[model samples]
Target: MPQAAKRSNDVPGTAPNLVHPAVVNDDAVRTALAQHMSRISGSRTEITSFGRKSSGFSWITYAFAARSALGGDRKLILRVGPPSGLFAPYSVLPQVHALQALAGSGVPVPALVSSAQDGAEIGFPFFICEHIEGDVPAPWAASELDPNHKRVIARQFIEILASLHRINPDATPFASQAQGADRAELRAITGWRASLARPTARYYPLLDWGGRWLEDHCPLPPCRTVVHGDFRIGNFIEHKGRIVAILDWELTHLGDPHEDLAWAMMPTFNARSRKLYGVLERAEVIELYQRASGIAVSDRSLAFYEAYALYQAAAIQMCAVRAFEVDRFNDMRLAVMASQMPSIVRAFERALEAAA
Candidate 1:
């Protein structure tokens, strides 16, 4: 169980005196960065104005610029493990590997610069890449975009997901990373169940029951493909009404393609556009995906995964709350995450009942 939030180097909060020593202008990091950038564009440079902050749970993102010997500036983003501790067992290395494999595969992810697993240099594993510049409208503010643009972005989201699903699992580097004891179908079901088992009282009997249903009625001839464990509105970057880059690959893995589809369709993530789960109606998203990737998506399958997505999200939120309650790591944002669980659980239960 996650311990209650305590003052730790990893947790971020308003402690006036607590300057994060974990983040500093160190010589070794600067040297490594300079060398890495040298390889990219033959530029000998130094990291200038590196700033780090938590985007949410489990992520410490740094935005910085590199001044080249030629006096040009390149903006970059570095995503690293939190100083407190990671909320999930998965590593960022695989996300980088998957991104590398998908380069030119029609997926709309950020362009990768470099990734490192050697934790000694930065306290924990981290990856650096190009910083995508665009607007990510708050869920409530999604309406500010023109309705047609919203529809275009919505369709784009589904099509990009379909493109990822079409990637041959064996052709990707993360194939070994995804190797597990459970069969594909069982793996998908168990993964979500485990994610939700974090300490909390907002448990849903329907999710527990739905797990059994999924196990019993496994999809026919399972799809062994890459799954973006968390695919939602907040994860993408948009500019001029087009999705420029997909962010947050920390949860990428291999499983049924429907897993990604379901996550994208989760109601809690729908934000302001309640009319469409992820700002697009289920039918519209499905049609766009089918048209783009030439694959058939059944309504029944979408419904099953939709329920599973809610279960997965509720589990993540509960875990965040548990971290706060147990003093394992405390931040107001994480504590507030706990309060969202009841609504998430209620949504799942209603979906499960309607499906039944």
Candidate 2:
């Protein structure tokens, strides 16, 4: 939950001071945001509280409480893609289109308020959405869940994923990437491998080996659908063992459905309980997804994607390393990602050895 900043004198356009230590240049952000909200809503708006929510390397999130004459009081989330973020030159359109299309589709997602591709709004590509109240359980903390609650969450997790993959790709921006199974696999490999060039121009032997192995073992996907590229335990909000909303659609795209299954099965995410996400085993995930989607799961395809998942995870860590070293991103979480590289390499190596 985001805490409200202590109030003081008002900024020029804002109703009151909305300053937080984590927010850089709080005055400027408050004034600009107030003006933008007023113009969009056609009423005077005031941001009463603003606080940074997550230190994620890709996009900046802020949870704020606001009030206006037209609309009483409400909580909303502001997501911005800054120039120095890991994935630079970002656009929020893909996320916007997907959320719009998924409404009432049985998948829990926050309501989209507004979005802009151009940086004119907040000096960056950004969007605002109605805030959902829930707690995000860290991957390692999965063991702490109550036994009954864990069972309920595990069922919801796979069911929601199956529902997402059943949506028509043509209705969303991801249709451009829904070429085929081969293209989807190759696109991910090529893009992530290219990202390795930015972090000091150094060679990564394990990543190179894993990438090559993925290409050699690529399997035809069971079905190509919309893949929630980051659909793991920690990304969803849960309240009373029920998922209220699935967060972080930045990496969502059209690809092999198994890619998400493989990501959820990663051992790094199952640290404490040793089960996938500390609730289900590998076989259980495949069985549940197959029953729900009616798409058979191929063990070979899952194996191939598991390797690709590890490779992609390593590449993303490299992005964080570059953000910290070269872009001078202040989030220490990015710096910590540098230390997790070795563990990823070891996991990649083990996956290959077992597959062999």
Candidate 3:
């Protein structure tokens, strides 16, 4: 349950000065951050700028500037997986391990500075990373990108996709964590089945049918590596006309590369222009990825992963609904997400039927 918001001095935004009901707020987070930074750097530290970011539902994300005796001024992000966060049993280890695994792999990600699963110091498990400067062009919003820029960005996007899929899982620390493709598919199915089984969440026939279809048709990937679970247009940071970093690894795991590819092509992530991630056409993306990775993408397998992606998406949204119903978190964002389930299921059904 969320704590009652204590009265405080007027703060600029909705979550400043610990006004937000959740455990992570301006006061608690600032104190915990200073303590952690000081311990890590062996010097006193003071927080300069601190505020909550406006996006995301799974974690309580805050961006702040800190001044330390040794490190000087630094910009960083603090992500706390509150007990009430949308995803329960929050663990920072997987994301931290992923950043460590992808360090030199051409896939751009934020630098992981520190992470702790223990909530003793802070109110929840958390990870901190360098804050990259960039503008996020949301797919839902009108794009201001010119043709040349779009083409350039699209090339980079496809190349990065290729690079991400090309990383050899055996060489990295992810080898043990990498469930062979078959087990990965089974885990996804069982996990979503359990989330939907929660009585509070409304049952949707399309989701059930879609899940069954996926079980009967799950594909064994040509190979499995690190799947960035949510790789789409809006999840990256665009700075000075190029994509600098890919953000949001909460859903990341070791699975089929096609999962990431199909996820990027999901219609929910598309806007009016609707090019692959609002950049390249689907054919262009497939061609570039195939040429760069030297792996032929099987269309049959892509269809299976595409349906799995939709099913996973619906399960995620329903998790939000379950969290809300159980009074785990009171954010209206979860409610809005729950409201989108029917449409998401409809799309999933349509895709499944077409594939059938």
lDDT of 2: 0.77
Candidate 2 wrongly placed segments (more than 4 Å): 1-24, 176-182, 199-202, 325-332
Best-to-worst order by TM-score is 3, 2, 1
lDDT of each: 0.68, 0.77, 0.76
Error in Å for residue 189 of model 3 = 1.7
Residue runs of model 3 more than 4 Å from their true location after superposition: 1-22, 179-182, 272-274, 325-329
Q: Please give the range of 10 consecutive residues that has the lowest summed lDDT in model 3.
A: 1-10
lDDT (Cα, tens digit) per residue for candidate 2, span 1-356: 11124345657887765444233344676677788788888899999999888765567788887789999888999888765455666878778877887878878999998888885547778888999988988888766767678768878988999999888888777776565434766877877877875545346787876777777677776666888888888888998768999888877877788898888777777664547677677778788989998778877777777778888889888887776665555567777888888888887788777665
Models 1 onward score TM values of 0.81, 0.87, 0.88
Per-structure clash totals for the candidates = 10, 0, 0
**Which pairs clash in the backbone of model 2?**
none
Q: For residues 57-96, what per-residue lDDT tens digits would candidate 1 score against the true structure?
A: 5766778888887758889887776445536433777679
lDDT of 2 at 348: 79
Model 3, 39-148: lDDT tens digits are: 88889989999988864666777999989878899999988887545566698877787788887669888899888888646768889998999887777762565767
In candidate 1, stretches whose alpha carbon ends up further than 4 angstroms from where it belongs are: 1-44, 70-72, 86-90, 178-181, 191-213, 272-274, 277-279
